[model samples]
Target: MKIKSVNLETVCGITSKMPENDKLEVAFAGRSNVGKSTLINGLMNRKSLARTSSQPGKTQTVNFYNINDLLYFVDLPGYGYAKVSQQTVEKWGKMINRYLDGSKVLRLIFLLVDIRHKPNQNDLQMYEWCTHYGFNPIIIATKADKIKRSQKAKQIKQIKETLQVVEGTPVIPYSSMTKEGREEIWEYIDMVYEG
Candidate 1:
């Protein structure tokens, strides 16, 4: 799908604040600093479209971006930030859960993971949650450029093992810095939109 136009429509703190339109929505969810924003910007072929940040847990709200007036790219707040209090994390969890369970138009979920590290407990939990809720999750392993080409397979295997992803589900290795896996990611998006 060609991205003719992309614009931030709204920053929603709760599900009620989400855009009123019933466009197809694909959400991005992952741990803090997993390069969710960067991947979005890369996929749109625009710089700073999703507001990349150096600090983890900077995105504190569910941001909806209107794409070509046909679909919505929901940028969810990252989880597993240690600096924040337990209460704040619990509150964010509630908000995210509400949006995930309540959104009728949410078709696909892209779960981002830092390729340099193994999938943590938070990542596994999120994957399980998606499965339990009946959402199709496409695992995106970001920062692939940081690793050597020969080691890519090993890393992918480790990630799959750690995350316990089942067969047939895609686990794409991506690099926002190099724009790697951009086409593959878009292809996944196209398949979702077409389906």
Candidate 2:
């Protein structure tokens, strides 16, 4: 799980075709402004390789990061941004769906949700879509550092129950600020990729 080399390998827009990559691919999906970029930056041990902005929906394209040429960390475009029009959202949806249906080496999908709030309609729908795609997504509750230590279990339980995840799904609480749960996430990834 040591990151020896990382590159912003490819950027696929709505019309762009997904790379026919030979390496295993892991993807991240979440609502707009849910710290996906921050998580990616934390995982890569980089400051801003995956652009992080205060604004939501900044990532409009599917970004593929090459991790030591071992695998591709695919960042799907963020969903559920209110500022954009419905047509734009639909385009993003179709683009995401295309990647999900088309990628051959896609191994796992990590669905991110905010730890402080109940998953909204978009979150529920995304979870359902991931399941429908035949992926048992590992949920990552982001911004864990914002919550109190005592509230961790309750929040995690709420996430699991709200998503109604299948048994044995791992929901790791992550914080970009404290970098807590980063190692656990990497360990889980290693187990899945190397076990």
lDDT tens readout by residue for model 1, 1-195: 778999899888744465665788889999888888889888887888787767777557888998998888998889898898877787777777778777888888999998889988878888887887887689999999999999988988898899888787788999977878889888877876788
Residue 95 lDDT, candidate 1, scale 0-100: 75
Which residue pairs collide in model 2, if any? Answer: none
Q: For model 1, what is the alpha-carbon lDDT of residue 117?
A: 92
lDDT of 2 by residue, 24-111 (tens): 8999999988899999989999989987756677557999999988888999888888888888888888898899889888889999
Cα RMSD, each candidate: 1.5, 1.2
Candidate 1 clash figure, as a count: 0
